[model samples]
Target: MVSYQNNISSIDNNADADIPVAQYVRMSTEHQRYSTENQQLAIAEYAKRHGMRIVRTYADAGKSGLRIDGRQELQQLLEDVQKSDIEYRAILVYDVSRWGRFPDPDEAAMYEQTCKRNGIQVIYCAEQFSNDGSLQSTIIKNIKRSMAAEYSRELSVKVFAGQTTLIKKGYRQGGSPGYGLRRQLIDENHNIKGMLKRGEHKSIQTDRILLVPGPPEEIETVNFIYRLFLNDGMPERDIANLLNNQKIISETGRPWTRAVVHQILTNEKYIGNNVFNRVSFKLKMRLEKNDPSKWVRKDGAFEAIVPIETFRQVQAVIEKRSKHLDDSHMLEILKAILARHGALSAIIIDEEDDAPSSMTYRNRFGTLLRAYSLIGFHPRRDYAYLEINRTLRKRYPDLISEITSNIEKRGGWVTSNPDNGLFTVNGELTISLVIARCKLGQNGRNRWIIRLDSSLKPDMTIVVRMAICNSTIFDYYILPLTDFSPETLPFKEFNTFTLDVYRVDTLELFYQLTSREALQEVA
Candidate 1:
C-alpha cells in the first residue's frame, strides 16, 4: 500500500469505518442554491438519511467550472484519493454540476472513474437516482454534465452580447485604460461618479465605466510621444529611451519599453475609439487574436487625447516605414549596428534607427538568441546564461515526449496537458519535469538551481540537472510534493541524507513506480 501518513492533514482519525465520507462543494458565481453553505446543508441532510458521517470537506469558492486548472480544492481531493491511508470511503457532492461543468463530459467521467477505481464512490447528494452503477443514473449524469456545459456556453454568449451593447453605448467593458487615460465611474444616467484608481472596480451593477483623459502632465506626455514619433521621426526605442532619460515611467510604474511606446502610437483609445474583440479567450480555452474585420469598434467613444488626423498620419507613416525588408537586408542592418556599438542586445537592436524592431527579429528568427547566433554574436555575462537556457528550453519538449512514451510503455496512462506540459499519470499522479542548469558554487562544487512552478502543484516533480558541459543530463531528482514546496531550490553535488535519498542516476525507479505487474489466477 502507498504510504501517505504525512501527505494528508484533514483526515478524521476519530471517524469509524461505518460510512465515513467527505463532502465536496463548489460555487462559480451562480445562484445561492449552489453556495457552499447551502450545498453543505443539503449534503448533511442526505448523509444523515444515508447513514453516512461527513468527516472532511473540500470546497472551491468563486472558481470557474469550465476547467480544473484553478480549482485547488478539487485537485487536492483527487490527489488525496490516490493515497492508501485516506480516511473516507465515499465523497459526497451537492450534484453532478458541482462535481464539474467540464466542456468535455468525458473529462468529468475520467475524474469520477479515477475515484471509483481507487475504491472511493462519488455520491451526488441531490441527484434523483442512486449512483450504484445503474443505467438510469449513468444516463442522467451524462445528460446533466452536457447541460451544465451548455449553460456556460449560453451564459458566455449573453455576456458578450451585453458587453458589445455597452461598448456601442460608450461604456468600458473590461481592462485598464491606457497610459494617459483614467477609468471614470458613472451612474445609469451618465452622471460622473468618480475616477477609479488602479486596481479599483465598480461595485454597483448600474454603475458604468468610461475612459477619460488623465492628469494634464500625462496628456501632455502622450502628445509629446506622438510629436516625437511623427514630427521628429524618432523610432519607438529612441522615444522610450528619451522618456527614461527624463525620469518618466509608463502607467505600469516601470521604465518605458519600445513595445509600450509603439502601443501608445497605434492604439485607437488615444483617438477616442472603443475597440473590442481584438483578442478572445472565452470559456477558459485557448487565446485567439481576432481579425480586424471581426473586431467590434466604436469611433469617438472615449475622450480624445490625440487628434484623429495626427493618429491617422502617424499610422500611415508607421505602415510605410515598416515595409517588409528581406532577411539579408535585415541581417545587414544588425551587422551594421553591432559593428558600430561593438555588441548586440535587444535594446541595442531596437534602438538602432535603421534596423527593424527586436520584436521583428524575434518573429523572423524565432528568438533574439537565434538571431544573435545567426550573426555569430555570443555576448558575455547574462547573455551566455540565456544561451544555455535557450538550449534547455529547446530540449524540454523532447524530454516531455520521452517521459510520456516511457510511462505509457510501462502500461501507465498519461494525459499530457498541451497548455502546461504537465502529465497526469494513470489518472492518479500529476508529474512535472523541469530542467535545472548546472553552475559552479562558491565552494567550487557543481551546483544546480531548480525552479518549480508551485502554482500547478504537481504531485511529483522530476528535476533533470544538466551536466557541467550544460549539454547532457547529469542526474535526476524525483521529489514528491509533500517532500518539497519551495518555488526555487538550490542543490549541490552532495547534500543531506534526507534530500540525497531522492537523487538518482537514472529514471529506472520512476518507471518502476508506473509499471504494471500481471496477477496470477488463484484456485
Candidate 2:
C-alpha cells in the first residue's frame, strides 16, 4: 500500500507517501460538446502545481450527462475508493457537473458520502469546493444546476430556430469555403466583417481572396459538373472519376469521393435555395443519426449557380438511372434514350441563340412574319414539345420501331395542283405545322418577299400541317412544329390559311382532327 504525504494534513484521506495520484476527467454528452477540451486542460494544470504524481486519466467522449452512476469512470473510481487496501486516497476533477449531468441528486450526495465515509477525499481542482455534509449549500447548488440544464436545452432550441430563419432568408450556412471565395461574416449591409479563409481566420480581405460566390475557376468547375451530369446524364462515380483523373481537387484540395459527387448532384443550393443545419445532430456523439424532417429548407436564399429546372433535371435523371456498375448497361441504354428524348419536361424556357437548343426540344412558340408562317390566316400552333420519346419507348417498347420510323410519302395525296395538303415527304413520322403568315423583316436578316416592314416581329398564324412522327395502335408521336426561323417565312394579310391532316379509318386521329378543324374554321 502507498503511504500518505505528511505535508497535506487537511484531509484524512490524503494519498500515502509513495503512491501516485490519479485524475478522473469525464465529459457527459451535455457537457462534452464544444467546451470539454478546456476542462481537461485546466485539470492537468491543477495536478502539476501540487507536485502530485499523475497516475492515470479516464475519459468518455459522448456519454449521457444524466447520472453519476451512468459514468463508467465514476463507477470505477467509487469501487476503487471502497476497497479497503487501495493505495489512492484522493480523487481529483474539474467540477461536480463533470461528476454527473442529471443523476438522482441523491446519487451525487451518496457518492460524496461514500468518499467521506471511506478513506478517500473528493476534490474539484477547479471549483475547489466540497460535498462534505454541507446539505443546505449543496441543495442550492443542485437547484442552479437544474436551471442551467434547462437553459442549455432552451438555448439549443433557440439556436436551431435562428439557423432555420437564416436559411429561409436566403443565407446558407457555409460549408468548406471554396478557393478565392472564403466564407465570411457580414454586417447588415453585406459588407465583410470577418472571414474564414484557407481554414484560418483573417482580418482583411486580400486580392487573392474572394468573398463572392467563388473563384472563377471554381465556378467554371461547378458549371462543368452540372453540364456533364445534368445535361449529359453521367453517373456520379463517373463524374468523380473524371475529376480525379483530371487531377482536380476539391475546395480543400483533397481527392473527391462518391459522397462528394452525390452531394453535388443532390445539393439544391445551386438553384438559389438554402439548407439549414446540414451537419448538426442530437449530440456531439460520433455516428449519431439525424432526423431528416429536422433538416431545414429555404428557397431563393442565395445567388442561384444554376437554374431550378436544370437542378430538377439532374435529380430526375439520377432517380431514373441507377448508379451501379453492374447496371451500367441498363443505365447506358436509358441515358441514351433520355439524351435523345431531352429534358423536355424540365421546363427549359431559356436557350442559347448561337448554340443548339438544350435538352428541352418541345416548346410552344409561334411566328407568322414569313409567307409560310400562317396557312391562310389560321391560328398558329403554340405547342411546346416535351419530346417524350423515352417515356414512350419505356412505356411501350413494342411500338418503338413504328414510332421512330418515318412515314412514307404518297404521291398526289392532296388537291390536283397541290395548292394545299402538301405534307412533309416522310408520312409515318409525327410532325406538326402551325399555319401562319410570314412577314418580312426590316433589314438584311429580317427581309422577306412577303412583307413590307423589316422591324416587325412574326405575325400569328393558324397551325395547319400534321405528319405522323411515330405511331402505335392507340398513340402517336406527334410534335407541333414551331417556326424555327420566322425571318424566312413572311405572311401577308391577304393570305388564306389551310390545314390538312391525313387520317386513316382507325389510327389515333385526335391530334390530326384537332389541327384540321382548328385550321378549317380560321380559314
Candidate 3:
C-alpha cells in the first residue's frame, strides 16, 4: 500500500487570493480512495480555503497514471498551460501521484517543469509539500515520485504472483481458449454459472473461469485437423488450404492459416494440460517467449479434446521435421526455390511443398533476408524498400522535433507518446508524421507512395514527400482522417486537384491552424 503526506497548507502568500485555477484529477480503477469525485472534493475544499476560483476542470476517470497515452484530460491541461492567454494561472491536482506515476520520475518532473516554464503554478492540493521549489519541498517531491513508481512496481509483482497462483490452481489466465474451447464461469463454491461469450468477463469477484469444449462443429474441426496431420501426413499449410477450401472459418471469422493450424496442432491445452509463463509481456514491455523450463504446467486441468498419446505423436512429427532440416539442407531447398521461381517470398516459400516453411528458415537464420543472402537471391524491390525505410527511420525523429519546434514557435503545445510517434497539438488535434519515399518509375517519373497507419488513427496525417534520391523534401500533404480512408495513398509527380490541393511547400498554414490568437475587445 502507498500513503500520501496530506499536510494541506494555505496557498502561498505571494499569490493573490481569488485567482482563477484549473483542477486536474485522474483515477485508475486500481483504488477507490483516489476517485475523480473524491479528488474533486479535496481540491474544491483546498480552493475554498485558499480563496482560489475553480474556473475549469480536467478529469481523467478510469485512466492509468503510469503513462499519459490515454489520459487526454491531463494532456489538455498541460497544453492549455502553454497558451499565451490561458485563463488559469495555477493547476490544482489532488496529489503528486495523482498528477502522474510515470515509471521514470524524470517524466513527472519534465511535465512540472513544462508548467513552470509557461508560468503556470502546479499545486498538489493533498500533498504535505508545498511545491515551492525549496530544497526540502524538492526533496520530498522527488521521494514521493519514487514512492509512486515503486508502488506500481510492487503492485505488478503481486498481480503476477496472484495470476500465476491462479493458473497453477487450474483456472484460466487471460487470452481466448482457442477455436474449439469456451470459457465457463464458476463461483467460488465451484457452482456452474454460464458460459462467457466472446468479450464477456466475470463481474463477480469470487467467480472464476475454466476452459471447456466449445461448439460441436468446432470440436469436429479440431479433431479433423489432428487426424489429417497424423493419419494422412498432411502438412499444416495443406490442412489450412483444405479447411479454407471447405469454407470453414476460424474463431476470428477468418479463413484458417498455416500458423493457426500449427497452433491448434501443437498447443498442449487440447490435451488438458494448463500452461503459463510460456510468454512474458510484463509492464508494457516487449513480448518475449520464455524457455520451456520456466513454464508452469498443470496436467488434466480441463477435459481432453484430443488424446494425449496422439498429441505427443503430432509433437514428435513436428520436432522431427524441425530437427531433420539442418541449416545446409534448408539453404539447399531455398536455393532450389529461387532457381525455379526466379524470385523468393514468404508466399512462394509456403506454396512449395518440397521446401521448408519460411518461418523455419527465419527461425534458423534470424530473418528471411539473411536466408536469402545465404541462397544468393536478393529481391531488388525488397532491398530498395529496405534502404529507403532505413533512411526514413533515421530522418524521422529530427523531423518530428522540427515540426514540434515550429508549432511551439506559433504558440501551440505538442504532447507526444514515445511508444508510438503520435503527438497531440494544443490538445485539439492528434497528428502522425509519415515520410513518403520517392520511387523512380520506368518512365522516368518520380512517384511517392504514402502508407498511412490508420491504426494510430490520427486526426490529421502530415506526409512529407521526398525529392529525387530522397536527398531533399519535395512537398507536404496535410490530410484529414475524414478525407483519407485507404491504408496506402500513391502519388505521381503531379496529382488530381483533390489531392494536389493539400500539397504545400511549407507548414506555415498548418502552424497557423494550431496557433491560438488572443482576442481584443473594443468598447
TM-score leader: 3
Candidate 3 wrongly placed segments (more than 4 Å): 1-16, 324-337, 345-371, 383-523
User: Estimated TM-score per prediction?
Assistant: 0.67, 0.41, 0.70
In angstroms, give how far residue 193 of model 2 lies from its true place: 3.6
Query: In model 2, what lDDT does residue 239 have?
Result: 78
Model 3 C-alpha lDDT per residue in residues 377-477, reported as the tens digit of each score: 87665544665677688889878888899888888899998887899999889999999988767675788877776678899999899985564698888
Which candidate would rank higher by TM-score, 1 or 2?
A: 1
Q: Per-residue lDDT of 54-73 in model 2, one digit per residue for the tens?
A: 56665655655554323556
Q: What is the lDDT of residue 208 in candidate 3?
A: 96
Worst 10 residues of 1 by lDDT: 1-10
lDDT score of residue 11 within candidate 1: 33
What's the residue-level lDDT of 46 in candidate 2?
60
The whole-model lDDT of each prediction reads 0.82, 0.47, 0.82
Pairwise lDDT winner, candidates 1 and 2? 1
State the lDDT at 481 in candidate 3. 86
